[model samples]
Target: MSQADNLIQRLFSRRAGSLLPLVLLGVLTGIIASLVMMSFLFLLNATLGGLNGKNLEDFEALTWHWQLGLPLAGSLLLILLYRLTPPACQSVGLAYVLERLQFGQGRIPAANIGFQFVAALIALGSGHSVGREGPTVHLGAGIASQIGQLSGRPPSQLRLLLGCGTAAAISAAFNTPLAGVLFAMEVVLMEYSLLGFAPIIAAAITASALTNGLLGTHAILEPVSLSLASYRELPGLLLTGLWVGLLAALFQRLVLVFIRLPLTSRAVRLLLAGAITGGLALVTPQILGSGYDTINLALSDGLPWPLLLGILAAKLLATAAAIGLGVPGGQIAPTLMLGVCAGSVAGALLPGASDPALYALLGMAAMMSAVLHAPLAAIATVLELSLSAEAMLPAMVVVLGANLLCQHGFHLPSLVITQLRVRGQELQTHPLRTALAQRYLSELADMSLVEWSGEGAPPRSKATALVVKRDQHYYLLNPAQLEQRMAPDTLDALLTPERRLQRLERDMSLLDALRTLQDDTGAGFLVPVRRGRGLVTRARLVHMLTEEGGLY
Candidate 1:
């Protein structure tokens, strides 16, 4: 290796050295993700402007025929695009990123990223009632994974980079850096620690700064002046939370049902979804695209109760169908829109409580928390976007009610986890396993012993463990076993089936190595360390458990 390569390797091999590089990487990830998301937004807006001479989200300006035709054409095009692409490259969005993190060692295909960029543009630009955040996440995580692979980092570090990218994407997309960090921890990483938190926070800040520099400091949602009028309004807020929780549950159930449908053909599914969205769009064009305008309207209390309910019903069906039918977009915006309408309706129904605007904000928090099973992140997003401290108590109450309803009453999993299950993959998380996976077997293997000779000779070294070779197989022999076998003078005794040697790679995680050791009762395992093959036994695990404080 070159001198620089050697220096980098040595630096990363140390814990302290690992931090600076990862933090720098996180910054780079944020900048790149922000640029990518900005480009996506520009392209989408430019396309929409060219087509309709209206704002990117103003599908309402489109003629009735165009509203119906755009999604239908886009669906047909998506079907053709999927057919042309490889099946491996067809997977996109948050669930795909999670699946790769779990089973693919944070390796995302470049083709999938490219496909998502195009597919999301088409889906959103054509008013498919899906949000762009999902594609932004896929693109961002893909970039980070690619960078990590190119850097030749270990799987553990690669996973961290993936989280960094995910946080960066959300930060840039919504201009909510805190929410980005929380989302990465709660939804993507599914765990949090000081080590992971630092880099993710760095990434979120970097991305948010870059996004603001390029796209200006405009929030994704309009800032609203709202608050609970009185403490007595708490009961009404709780009721709104329950209402949103039910809607969230129903939305999840609809999406899950569609995902699990017996239909196998992608084109057929897209066609059915397009038909549903088109039918809904004909009635209420606001249901098309991410419906941010609809949300703004609800927040202003501009839409009457009947109109708000109609939009809510249409958006719910359209978004559920779009997601269930495999549209390459996000559900974050849709959930926000749903929350706004639900909260507005509740506010209108409950007399003398608070402004409908406050209820809209609370509903947004509740739906997001319930559907995604990420209450902390949802609350963070609301606080960051609304910039209203007064909204916090009501948001918390609503979010808690929604969470309790979803978790206890409905027993529904998070949206991404549910999708993962439908794809036959289970998300695994354990504190010990997570800790051990960060450490390689080489770090814990016993390397003090010298190889053992035939029975007559004692081991040259004073090491407690000795490696004995018999018939091309290696076994770890303790001093007692060595003494016991000296009288027998038979190598065959040490070569019993239970005492057979097993091999482990130095780069393998301690957790994986320990799992292998547990599954097979061997004399010991031979780990190919940097210097040479080293002997590892149950004692190594004991050393790791005892020496590595806080691992559990």
Candidate 2:
């Protein structure tokens, strides 16, 4: 290896638990993730600049014929691309990232990233009613995963870097570092710890700083001050939460319906996805693209209730079909629009609220929280974008209400989870597994051990494990068991089915080890360590999680 490569590998191995290496890794990840995200944003803007200057998402400027043709052309192109591309590379999105993290040990192919770049650019620039955030997630996580794989990091650390990239992407996209961190934890990692927070926070800050420096200063959503008038508005806020939850559930259901449809032909699905988006754009041009313009209008009171309602319905259908069928764009932007429209309509129906804008903001939070099932991240996003500390209580109320209704009332999980489950990929984020994943199994392995000849047993078992080699593989046993295994015809029975542990070539995170541990309940995993083979047992893992709360 090159000198720097060797140095990095050495640092990674030596200080795997240190914060300094992680902080530096986070910064580097942020820089690359932000630069890549900006590249996509720049291309998207330049591509769409002809249709709408300064405002990238304004499909209203397009004539009806252009609006009708753009999405269809884009869809045709995507269909062609999908047909030619390998099936493994076609899966791209935040849900894909989650799936890889849980099942694939954070390994993402580079081809998928390339596919996402092209697909998302075409889908978003062509006014497909999808957002950029979903594409951003795919790009960011894919890039980070590739980097970790190249660096020769283990599964656990690779997972950490992947999350760092995800956080950086969001921070760069929105200039909301806190929201990015929260989103990474709540939606991406689905766990929180000091080990994760430090690097992720650093990555988010770096990403936000770089994007702000390069893209020039502008708000994704303008900061609007809002205040609650009286106790009377509380009921309406709760009702708005319920309304947004219903809308969120409907959006998910519509997407699922399109997904489950019997349109087996890829060409037909892509064609209809594009045709539906274009047809919606024909009547309500504002529904095209991410619909940021529509959101701004709702926040500014520019859209009348009837027009807003029409736009909302059209946008919902367009987004569900576009994203559900095959488009590679994001869901967050469209979700925000849905929330804003739903909130605005609710505000108009129920007077005595402070302003429709406040409701708009609340709707954004509630819809996001409910749809993504990320209440904390959604609340953080709105708070950071709006810069209204006073909105916290109401945002929380609406977010929690929406989440409860969407999850319990409708029996739905997060959209990403639902998608993966449909594809037979279960994202196991059990609290115990999550906790175990954070720890290095090698560190907890019994490293101090003695090797025993097949003929005899060791002297003692005090703070030292006993290992025996048979069939060129090492297995762990105590002195007494070693003696028992030396008897005639006893080795095969003991080694094969009774107390044999699987051997690992190197140290792995407890999460990966635990996954491999499910096959046999006899013993744990064995890894080659410095002195001798290090043994990691499943019982030890459970004990660590339940009893060693204060130890780490």
Candidate 3:
């Protein structure tokens, strides 16, 4: 690490203690994230539109042969891309981002970000039934993480940047700044406080403004003002929530099936996903791209019963197959498409006159909330889209109700959590472990330091402890031992070879440190010595966790 990185790491060890710098960094991160999203959307549109003199259209206008062959061709290109990329750098998307931020310190490699940029373009541009939001979210967070990694920030500050970038991405994609902030908190951080709120909010707002100004787009969806028809519709609303919850469960279950399949080869998985998408597109072309046109059509009451029913079955299966089989794309836009279709169908069947847009809105909130277990984010999305308080009442009822069914009735975890679990990274179920994993190692570093590694008489300092380096290892010497003449005379002898310590990187968290210590219970932590840098022992981690009400 550079000296500047070390300086920033040590400076922000106490999370959120520096609000000014955090907010400033949040703005910078948001700006970068917005430019990335603008480019992503432009490139995707230009590629899809360039085929037939259409300016910015999806694959809906494509020839039958192009629609049939694009997904398969995309898979072939991805196979070539994957073969050239290293296995370690192959991981992309939100789950991959969560793994890097939550498990290790928030040091996302730049190469993965680069791969996602190209990979998402191939997956979405080639008519895979996935969304652009996922790749954009990954891109935003990855860029912020790269900044943090370069600056040498601690995990806490780095985590803040990660959240900021996520918020910016979602904000830019959907033009919902509040939803973006909540998503960063509710989905990524999995915890929240005022310390996180300011920077996240700043990032979300900045990103939303930048994208809107640059792209001349605002409120991508023509969200209508909606309210309940009557008290009699309460039953219908309840049924709608329950129905949407069932769809959410089915969506997750389909992905789960593909995930658990015996097919082990990445090549087989990608090709099979491509083949399934191609087959489904033959049945209904609506599942070809991100399906934004379908979503708009549903909200406008344009889809007929047969078409709605067709999309209900085909899009669900196509998205499940694409995502479950490990396509490096996002599921958010697809989830919205599925929700709108399900909601429109539910509205048609319910025994009351209703606006199709209202049902579509409710369905969007319910499925998104239930599947991700993120009701607040869903509600915030509804409120922002509607720009009124009317959407909140029903949004809450259906959103929370569906979440209850998906979590309690179906006993399902969030989709993102499921994505992690399938890859053998279980949620840190223990509250304390999860808490510690969010904290940094520098918080427990020893503050007192009196280096005596020189050959002279230790420079005559009044420090209480003597620390020295020998053979690139740090040894904690006793000042009392020196006073009693029991210690070795020379600095070389003062550093004994008795017990070697593990080299702990300055970026690791307390949880990471503890895990390393667990490998050899006899070993302790020894940070590389720079100017005034001190060791962090195993006992420090224990003390941080077991102290007065820290665990409880």
Model 2 quality (TM-score): 0.88
Q: Candidate 1's residue-wise lDDT over 344-380, tens digit each?
A: 8898898765788888889999999999989999999
Report model 3's TM-score to 2 decimal places: 0.88
Compute the lDDT for candidate 3. Answer: 0.79
Please give the lDDT score at residue 439 for candidate 3.
72
The candidate, 1 or 3, that scores higher on lDDT is 1
Models 1 onward score TM values of 0.87, 0.88, 0.88
Local distance difference test, candidate 1: 0.81
Instruction: State in Å the error of residue 292, model 3.
Output: 0.9
Residues 300-411, model 3: lDDT tens digits = 6567867887998999999999999988899887888888888888878887766767778788889889888778888887677656567677777778778888999989
Error of 2 at 254 (Å): 0.7
Once superposed on the true structure, which residue ranges of model 1 sit more than 4 Å away at CA?
1-17, 429-492, 496-501, 504-516, 523-537, 549-552
In terms of lDDT, model 2 sits at 0.81
Which is the better candidate, 1 or 2, if ranked by TM-score?
Answer: 2
